[model samples]
Every structure is written in structure tokens, then in C-alpha cells.
Target: MNIRKRYLTLILIVAIALGAVGTYVGLSVFAEDTSLNNSGFANSDPDLIAELADQQENIEENMGKMSKVVDAFSIIQENYVEEVEDTQLIEGAIQGMLGSLEDPYSVYMDQETMKQFNEQIESSFEGIGAEVSMKEGNVTIVAPIKDSPAEEAGLKPNDQILSVDGESVEGLDLYEAVNKIRGEKGSTVVLEVNRPGVEDPLEVEITRDSIPLETVYADTKEKNGKLIGVIELTSFSENTANDFEKELSQLEEQGIEGLVIDVRGNPGGLLPEVEQILKNFIPKDTPYIQIEDPSGKKTRYFSKIEKAKGYPIVTLINEGSASASEILSAALNEALDYEIVGETSFGKGTVQQTVSMGDGSTIKITRFKWLTPDGNSIHEVGVKPTIEQKMPDYYYTNPVQVEEPLTLDQSDSKIENVQIMLEGLGYEPGRTDGYFNEATKSAVEAFQQDQETEVTGKVDEKTAELLQTAIIEKVQEGEDDLQLEKAVETLTK
Candidate 1:
């Protein structure tokens, strides 16, 4: 990613999803390229135009900056430094932009990548089945796909790739890293990995093999002193709707009552599959998603959201739940009024469509913004769980100190609030001691120093703002689902 700054990853995917083809049409004040019909799809069919309009409006509502992306892309296309293949340039632009955002969920997929992705969703692909990715500028393992070649290679999550076949891939593009790692079945791919708690990256190798994908797995568990039915979905793959039907039958066979769907750490798969999955729980003929363009023109995509038999439902999500996950959650939240538990979902609510060019290359463009049936845009601001879950330290990487000590120690209530929050997290403060003594002051001071706030040891408004660091933590501590749980507990009534 030759990124100047980390912009939103959704934006990059979105821009492509909208119109990755033709040319880079930068936004201009007037019709600068009058010959090209800057009106953009003005002559397209009514139905397509309607879809585009809805997408535009949804883009505005959720992520505000997309309005300018077209303009920038158009301008860059017209006047880039060097002449590059139109498709390559566009793909490069998307990859570069998404790379800068540093959001792992936001990504750009060229034709090959897109095909691999679609294949993964359909649950049938021939290759090593490891969920590989880049982290901290190095190719790292997210998870070895269940029984894929990468898993067989003994790869684990968080294993960083150092080299491929002894060729250093230290500073390589994501696709470049993937290109090196993926190959014909039975071909050997060697990788050097840096594992967690390990001082340095190490080397391991794997012989690629055919990878098969599956969807819709079910099991039973006991929660809240009741035997609850649990459905774990690895992806929204093709045939999911049929697979879902089979699961419904199984649930009926078991006479399951309550439902707990675990979509933790799931990266999106197929849209049709997600739509069907959601339809199983959502209301029939209800618009699962509504999109809008800049002009407020709306297009609603209906979900087959019909409640299956009778079941009290709860959907679980986490940081890795994205794209298709968002779609499924939106459908359930809109249709079933189900409660969600776990962390804030990875916000990837934009629609991506791939257009194949005459050549082997293709373009993935951001076409529309996806919204919940209630008209809530889940783009930048993701779907917040009704039951927010506080994860153990193993789950998240804390970038900012929840509370900085009083930066301007002498400022307002900043230091005091931080002390209070620390106590809230169960970290002992210098007593419930309200005073900003050495201990209280130290916590406040460290936060303040880290944040580059003034080091005055006083609790002020800035400290209060800083104390808000614990807000997510507080919410995650199971504050979102109190009412729902109460309702479910008394269902026997």
C-alpha cells in the first residue's frame, strides 16, 4: 500500500464497488469531460439508475467522505504521473488506499483475488485453505482454514510471514504476498512466520491442496441454565439457503427452542447466501436493506426474513465479523428483534460488484451502501450489539489508554475521572482515594503524557474526556442485553 495516510478501508472498496470500470472519473465542478457524459449513468435503464441512486444516498448517510472519492479518482486518472494499465492502475489505487487505512477488514480484490473469494464462499476451491493475511506490515496467519493445506502446514493465527521460498517478502503488497503463497495444488509454498510471544519470525512450508468450503453448522449448548441451540456459521457460502433448511430440520428434530448464532471472527462470504440466511429469521417480504444516493432516492432490498417455527434468538458477533456478517445481523436485528452479544462488529457495510473486462483482468467497484431495514446505515459506524461484550485482553489491541492520567495534571476533571475508570476496570487505584495523590497522579500522568496532554497533575474536563476511554469497556461488560435476557428467562411464563 503506497498510502499517504490511512483513509477508511470501506471507502476504497466502495469506490470500486460503485464504478471501477470505464475510467477514473474524477469529480469536477462542471462537466469538464462533456464528451464522456459526466452525468454518469444518466442513460442507463431505470432499474439500474434506481439502484445507483440508492447506493449514493446510503454512502452519504454512513461515510461522509465518499462524495469526494469519485472526484479524486477522476482527476487522478486524467493526470497520473506515469501511464499504467487502466485495470492495474485502478486495482493498485484501491489496494494502495485500503492498505493505508490499516483496517484489516477493508480490502480490494482483483479478478484472481475476487474469484478466490467467491470460490471460498461457494465452499469449494482447489488450493491450500489457510486464512492468510498481513499484519504490522508482514504477512500473518489469521487462522488456518479448518482442514486446509495451511492448517495442515501447521500454521496458526498471528503467525507472521517473513519470507517465501527464502525470498524476503518484508515490504510487499498484499496481492504480492498472496501471489507468492498461492499456487497450483500439490505445489509447495514455504513461509517464515513470527508467532506471538516468539522473539522472531520463523520458517514453515506447505504443499498446496484442494480446499473445500462448507456452511451452516449446528450444535447445542447450555446458557442461562437452559439447553440452548447454537448455530456456528463459518461463511455465507453458496447453497447456504439449502444448508440452512437442513439445519432448521435438524433443530426441529432436536426440538430446539432458543437460538444462539456465533458469527465471531467471520469475514464475509456470499451475499445471496447471507440474504437467504437472514431470510430464515427475518420477516418475509421485508426490506432487509435500504440504500440511498446523494439525492435521497431510495432502493430497498427485501429479505426473506421469516421467523422459522418458534425460537428465541440471539446472534453473536465480534471484531472479525464483517460484510456478510453485517448483512446477516442487519436482517435479524430488523426482522426478529433479536439481541446481539459480543464486540462492535467490523464495519463493512458497502456493496462490492466485480465487472469483468475484455481482458483477463477485472474491476471491483463500490456500488451501494447497505442499510438496515430501519434505515440505519452501517458503513463507518458498525452495528453495535444489543448486548455489548467485554472481551478479555486476548481479544483486542488497546491503542489509546482508556483513561490518560490528568494530562494537564492541573487541568479539569480529567485525572479524577481516569482514576475512577481505572477503579471501574478493577485496576486498583491509590485507594478509592479521590485525591490525585502520587498513585492517582501517576495513572493520570501516564495517560496525559502518552496523549501529549499537559502534565499538570490536576483532574479537569480533558481528564473527564479521557476517562471516557472506559466507555466501550463498560458497554462490553454486558450492558446491552439486560432487558432481553430478562424477557427470555421468563419465556416459560
Candidate 2:
């Protein structure tokens, strides 16, 4: 069989989870003109034709050496104790080949998985609305979409999924695990997640819902007597750039003096969407980004804008910011000398492109590495903020899971988390240590009284639920957002 005939078209670089609404940290590049025709080389360029001939000769030579694989397949199919399907054999062989590459980003998608992926691109689907990626042999959450069920359930970035609905996902690939997570609308999927710094695995129940395509949110803030425009980007979807432009125009019309571009929990999406957004800020004098091919060739991309924005701009990022988020933050910081405030971003600097196998299946392969305008690759090393600022300690505390009432003298990690939450809520929990002291009891009693619950100085199921609800409400209110305050302060100063 001619190997070249198997590959039909090249798709995007971003890996979209069949279960999730948007893609994780990576740019999407669609290579339509690079498809090969029957005669090879749709463009009919002489150099491409020569390259194709050379590649075909190499493939023929490799095919001769692949006789051992053919023999193994024949043996498995004909000499096995039980009958095996030909499709299974073929797919297993393909998966084995990809596994040999040892790159988790490069993966095979069966026909059903590919169909689901295509459907997600055209319209929203029912799922737990989060972007996940395989990290170190585990399916890890990159970021939950803003206003998503996952976010609402308190799922945070880097949470490793150990099982789905009581079934272990130990050996399943990213897409397989996603298949288990995806379901119809209003169906609850229980996820067993292993979070960092927590000794026990927590069970998270999320009701799947139809994820919307609204990726950009706009608002304004009055800080230090100056009207500051705030535009929060959840992901760089197909229409994100257009929506951002419209919101930005509206903010400008409101006579804002400073601007804050917030991408704290954005996972990332379409490459062109971010590139177009960058064009509005980055000047033509400097390159916004660089793409390095496998052969060490680098291509620099620059914006056409001649001047920068009239007002000072500050970018907000955190550990959940990745891919196109990193691209935008790095460009604004390195190319335009803007200030970046918050924690370091999630590092993801490689690019992937999907190749169709002509049988409704596809393979996404890592093809290139992306670099910042300063020629820095933030792959394992994420982009550092110019002014680093972390959220309150309670913000990183795990959810309070109480099987029994945690009373006085109880020493556990759950108690420590409760102490942190109590302290953050303005109650004086004398010690943040695991050992629950009298001060903690008093603080809990005070909290219970304030919340109109029973004055039991213990953390029961009701108290835990109420505590988590109160904290979530506080966070959503954005009243204690120190990072945003710092960004506004920087602009005002």
C-alpha cells in the first residue's frame, strides 16, 4: 500500500477534548493548501515535488523493513486462540507506532472520537466545560472555563483525574477518559480527582450542561479615581477577537484612562484569534511571536499596527493561564514593555497539527515550537510576571470534605484548611496549624452564629457546605482580589 495515500489533510494544532468545550494550551493552525493530490503536491511547486519524491523513496525503503510488523499482524490474526477484528489490529498497530514517539500531545483519534471533535468545533456540546491535558501519564485539568460547571464545582487547575463515575482511568488515553466524562445535558458525572498538596482524593460531582461560545467578558473598575477598563478572556475561540474588539471599543467610548487585560484562568484556543487580538496592541516595529519548525528554521510574525494604545495596559495572569494566553502576555511584556502582574503562567510552547488518515480517523502530532518575541521558549518554564502577586492563602486551600464533625483538638489537613478559610473570612483562627485549638473553636462558633447556623464549635457537614459557599461567593464578588488591586495600583502609580 502507498503510505502517502493514507494522509488526506492537515488540521489544527490545538487538541480539543471530546468531553470539553474548548482546547487546552496550544495554537490551532489549519494547513489546507498543503494537502497532496493524486499526482502529489497540490501547488505543483518543483521544490515540493522533489521533496515528495525523496519522501516516497524513503517510505518505500522503510516499508521493506516493516516486513516484521506485517508478519506479527498476520500471526496475531490467523494463529491466535480466538478471532480478532482486523480494525482492532490496525488501530492497535497505529497506536503502538504513536506510543513509540513518547509524546503525549501526539495521539490517535478513532472515527467516533474524530466525529465528536468535529461536532464540538461547529457547535457547543454537553460536558463539564473544562480543558484538560495528559501530564506525566495522568489526565490533568488545565483550566475550567469561566462560568462552567467544572469551575462552579470548585475544580482547579492541575487537578488530576483518577477515575470517572467509579471506574478507574489508569490506563485510558486522554480522549478515552474524556469520552467517559462526556454525557448528555443535566446528567451528573462524578469525578475522583487527586489534587496536589491534598493527601486524599476528593470526589467532585458535576452536572453536564451546554457550554456557550461567549469567551470574552468586559467591564470597568474605578480605581484611585481613574476609570480602568477590564476585559477578561476565557479562551481564544473563533469569534473571541471580534468580541474583544467590540468590547474594547465600547470601553474606549466610555473614556477609560487605563486598561487591564485579564487572562487568569484562560486555557487558550485558536491561533489566528490570538494573533488578530495581538495585532491591535503590538506595534509593527517588533515581532509578536516566532514559530520554529522541526528543522530549526524560525519564522517571525509581526503586527501591522504602527502605534501602541494611548493608555497604559496591565496584563493579569496566573498558573491557569496557558498557550495563547502566554503568547499574549509575553508579547505585551517583551515587545511593548507592558507590566504583567500575578503568578507565573502554565508553560506550553509547542504546536500540534492533526493529519487525517482518510478513514474518518486522525492523528495529532507535535510539529513545531513557539517562541516569544524575544526568542525565548516558555515550554517547561512558564512566563514570569513583571510584578509577581499571589492570591490569599485560603484561595489555594482545598475544599472541606467532612465525613465527621471536626471538633476541638482534632488534628487533620481538613482542619488546617478550615482554619485558613476561617481566618480569611475575618474570624480570628489563632493558629493555622493542623491541631485545632480553643481559638479555632471560638472562631468557628462566631462564624456559625454569623451564618445563623447552630452555635456548635465544630465543622460538620452543614458548616463545611456553608463555609465553602461563603468563600465561593466572596471570590466571585471580586472584593478581595488583591491581584486586580495590584494591577490597578500599578496603572495608577
Can you give the lDDT of residue 351 in candidate 1? 69
lDDT tens digits, residue span 1-493, model 2: 3332222111110111221111211111123434445543345345545654565455545555556666676678779999999778877877888878877778999988888766554457679999888888999999998888988888999999999999999988889999999888899999999999899999888999998768889999897789999999998887889999999999999999999999999988777888999999989989999999999999999889899999989999998999899999998999989999999998989887776665568888888989999999999788899999999887887778888899989899899999999988999989998889999999999999999999999999899988987877677677679899899999988
Q: Which stretches of candidate 1 lie above 4 Å from their native place?
A: 1-118, 131-144, 149-163, 166-172, 184-207, 222-227, 284-286, 292-298, 304-309, 377-384, 388-493
**How much lDDT does candidate 2 score?**
0.83
Q: Could you tell me which residue pairs clash in candidate 2?
A: 13-352
Residue-level lDDT of model 1, residues 215-271, one tens digit each, is 567876555566666677766667866877788678768776677776765666666
Cα lDDT listed for each candidate: 0.60, 0.83
RMSD of each: 15.3, 5.6
Winning candidate number (lDDT): 2
* Candidate 1 lDDT for residue 472: 40
